[model samples]
Target: MQCGFAAGSPCEVTCTRVTLPDLCGHLFLDWNFSFAGLIVEEGASEWQLRYAFYGDGDAGWVHVLVAAPLAEKTFPSIVKFVHAADWHEREAEDLFGIHFEGHPRLGDFILHDDAWQEGVEPMRRKFDPREAMRHRKPDEDWRPHRIVQEPGAFVMPVGPKYSGVTESVHFLLETVGEDVIRSTPRLFYKWRAIEKLAEGKSADEVLLLAERFAATTAFAHGLAFCQAAETVCGANVPPRAMTLRVFLAELERLRQHAGAIQEICESTALAVANAHAGICEEELLRISGEITGHRYLFGLLTLGGLLCDLANDACAKALEKSQKVLSQLNALEKHLRVSSSFLDRLEEVGIVPERTAMVYGLLGPIARASGMVRDLRRAQPYLGYENIQFDVPFEEEGDGYARLRILFAEARQSVRIMEQAVGALQSGNVRERIELRAGAALGWVEAPRGGAFHWVRLDGNGKVARYRIIPPSFANWHGFHLSVEKFAFQDFPIMLSTFDLSVAENDR
Candidate 1:
């Protein structure tokens, strides 16, 4: 399949597949025939290609791919795709010294430029850590660009702290009176250098790190990372492990969706609806915690199989809880929808049209809200989701309200899936013990946000030679800019909080 945009646009830009004399190339190419933009970064033996297309508004979409040299023994390259996907690409350039040719603006997306010496780049392979430690002064020139500025425009900065405790991230809101004209999210407050730190770690050790990439999406990331490791190692997980993995993945989805819906209610100022959603979320989390020791369902996955077996009693208990929560959530959703105030605030607010969604390549609830039916779980069934039946919720409105409704519907479907999966659990060895060999693998899992992909290459000693992770947040980050366009300033907080994007996930 030709990987192209789905919004009736054709990509005509093609690069010359030639050998590079130097380690990197930096140049920006503009497409004459389409609204697409191409950023090409040349490595020692590969070229990283990023395809970017502008949407109807200020938003854009980007897809990344690496063209490797015909010869073997070349280092696998890293390419950042979306215009808003800055942190990942910046990390890639910093670590590998690969230049982003046509990047409109590229600097240290994660590490502040002011944090290093005048000419030193800390992420390069040859960069010394001792020197960085010797000269640790905040870079005075590290001032981020303010995106929106006009007459009567004022800034409303939110977070780095909030009324409710959550991850720390700063949002720079550009407002004209009550309407939000532009919004920029300042992330990297919780940079954990996950990929760079994983270098040379054993496959098993790296799997643990992958699981911790995101507390909420631990199982999904672990599954994707392990599957990639298994692919490279040529290890085969048993059917029972695969089945259990599927069940756990869906369970994670249910919990996350429930929490997101609750957050939506909170954003809408519906205290009663928010409280009910919160209760449902707690129930889902408790069920997951009971089944797997971790409340977020972490550590349930291994390279070749699950860490342990799924208990029938635990499955039954989780299913029963889900059944009860579903009934209550349904009733609450109905009431919230009927409330005029809630509907008035949400409906058509932060509207992202279908065309805009495609341009930004929005995923999960954000994409579904725009009428795009692209779910990796359904489109490419990696786990046992192929056998399980469920509907992918979609809406044409593409507004905050539509996103809320879609999340509600997905939560109900997730419960139905859990019910079916719990009944299907049978007595068997839930794990397959096998020795992993040396190679490379690719693993993908449909996280609550969207698709999470992991590419892992192992050395002869079964250690990770290279690892790359693409979380769903990397795809949906651009939607923030799209949603804030043409909305009132006060609506910025509600719009941003509605998406509930994880900066940790993106920065990692």
Candidate 2:
């Protein structure tokens, strides 16, 4: 049954009390899972609240929900889980007014305008929305990850706006001579409280919002959102629809990978390569528009199936476009590989060790490039992925070069997947008529960047009581500093390009 109904609804998540955060480690070790989230939820009674620790597992996600009876203001921290917990926990402290006892840093993460007004948690319902949106005071400048100066080194701040990618993210690079001593990223400038805005939307309307989560992976995000709704509603997507969805998703992967590959070329100053890759990318988007009627395939996915069937000639054009894009990418890959100077700029520039990748739970090509084979497409086969035969290309280099190669390899694989999926389409209904009732479900898709996770809770009327979307970049962004460690100052742009992360995705 739907255990809880909204804020103050009994938590649908199973509650297990851990009076001490230390005990969480015992359960964590026994369960063999990693921390996915930590949050403080307003309890049914005003005298209490809850601190839930989410653990992601293969069987299903399990959360240890700790109830705090308002007798305590400070709760234990899980930074010991890994440094990754630091970000999520800090977010909890900032937005929920909950304090973490041992968190190394517990200040403004996503919420602050120069500084938060004393005694008011913007996320709390009691807080005035007008105050939250109040005009910034003169001389009050908000800088997310303010740069720290190194005694003998100079600190350089890169965009909260970088060329090529339209997002806000600040990067602090400390340089001594030509080598970078350190790098720190400040994000969330694009934060629109997407989850908060989605709270009252119907399940169908939320699908549209999901597609806007990240422009780079619109289709991937939409598919994940739909999957969660479908799961909760027990809607069986027909085989033909599933196959068509697969085609659309893979097409998105090819396009995004091409665009990222092009960005890398821009950073490396390969004008010719960048132009050609851009052309390939545009062609892919054009193909998507032809088949799904939206360049990003935004309107194509629905609760039970696609909004409609692919046009009769859609498959033919998709195949032709994919083949063309694949050939262009192959040529670009060859050019970069043979260019000694280009290869030199990329090789060993930014190396994130395999151990570090796993410790931080890195995702997508970043993890794959570091010798971690954790692509969910193969590991947790969702949708029609289990029906398709494809390869997930990985590399051991863990450097800019390896990341570039991985992008190219993954794009090639996307092309192969699209071709196979197109060939597998059969005649069947494309949409299933089902009602979204009160329930909750978790769904995810291996987006081009990495695994995008969506958790949805529907009210009795099928309106979204809650929806949390964690784009892959949200997890992948943490490992960025590790990749750039000990790299030269001039390589910063190139290294960043290799990752091609979307600050908007993480910021949202």
Candidate 3:
């Protein structure tokens, strides 16, 4: 075992596979570091696992790396210490065929037993995408995992399929009566293997997939991906591009919050309020399309900077129109606040304690509502966020209402950010020439949902060697069960709406 980098400052430490779990335990309990993500990389004759952690202020990030030969497939599970690594380990085990020796739950995660055969290991380098067509063989004896042993206890399954354009995700709500005792979420029903497909692709090509993976937060993910590529290539974006990036990012954030608020209203059966919120979301989407040529802001990010420069007049006009939309949203929020029925559904529902949020490493609005204060834009400034003035809205209640308030507050802040960014826009080029070098770097952003991380390694040929994404959904989904359990089954949809998690991001 050898340390690859220094003691701090985005360091990486290499250790034996046997010692990995203990070392991670020290980092978690002793150091009080937050678990960020886990990535598995393929080597010529071995496989490497990289565990990412968020260190204290100025320490930035710390990564622990461990490798085992292909023949020695099993590795120790760190879930005994870092509870947040549960889903990451399960996903790795299912996709890479690298078993975790102590993982209590591994199989039937991303690949459902009813559709995909066991031992497919789609992420292995040797696996072919063409083989997917012939791999559909349902397991006749498969049953959903159950922990409730009482005779009256039963599982009420809610959706591997749902209506109205929602993606696939199954939740087993175990209850003996009206209250849910245990809630288990099963995601990644339509896993695209986007990271596996990114291998050998140019940085520009992979950027497309990153943004499209979660279309709702397209620009934020695209910006994170571009930053990773820019770091690997040693390219610096122009000042104008940085300001515009902030402008567009806030634009996306505002639109996303509006949509989330709409969903929350709909969940409470506030039809009139839902209609108002939906109108606000639609208006913002229109403004986004008018400014960026895409309602979702696709094709707007490139390796070095944005794909094209935005005119100051257009950006300013868009900001003004968006501000009007924010005003309407604020009015709707004010009305909903006074509506006792609406308040009853959200005020005390789906509570996630501050301690539970931190233990699970929750992100974005979910973390903020729980009083975690883990916004990456403020903690680690990027894209000129340090130069901009905006507040990170948070609430202490950690309830459904708290999350909803965070969305409303954040939407207002987004408008303020865009206003500042538009006024500070510089006159210069938006793109820069890149010299793609063989290196790995992490790019991150305080996306609307929360902090998103993108890790990229480029080969000497200027193609991506490995691309790993830790979207906010992937982080927050791990903790979704915390809010669902102990609550009545009637509160399920309301709680789910407040989380505003994206299934597409998780499936990627």
Q: Determine which window of 10 residues in candidate 1 has minimal summed lDDT.
A: 20-29
Candidate 3: tens digits of C-alpha lDDT, residues 39-82: 88988998889998876457667889998888888999999888
Models sorted by TM-score, best on top:
3, 2, 1
TM-score of 2: 0.89
The clash count for each model shown is 11, 0, 2
**1-508: candidate 2 lDDT, tens digit per residue:** 1134343122344333344455446444455444444534453453222223233324334445566565466767766755556676777677667787778777757865464455556566465444445533634354444344556767677876666645677777777667877787777878877777777788888887898878778889988889888888888999889888888888888889998998898898988988998899899888887777788887878888888888646796778878987998898888889998888889988898887886676789988999978677776678757777888788997989999999999988887887888777888889999888887766778898988878787889989876777677877888788777677777888888898898878887
TM-score of each candidate structure, all chains considered together? 0.83, 0.89, 0.96
Clashing pairs in 3: 364-449, 364-450
Model 2: residues with Cα > 4 Å off, grouped in runs: 1-35, 39-43, 46-60, 70-73, 113-115, 127-132, 135-150, 162-166
Point out where model 3 deviates above 4 Å.
Answer: 1-9, 139-141
Q: Which 10-residue window of candidate 3 scores lowest in summed lDDT?
A: 1-10
Error of 2 at 272 (Å): 1.0
Which candidate should be chosen as best, given TM-score against the real structure? 3
TM-score of 3: 0.96
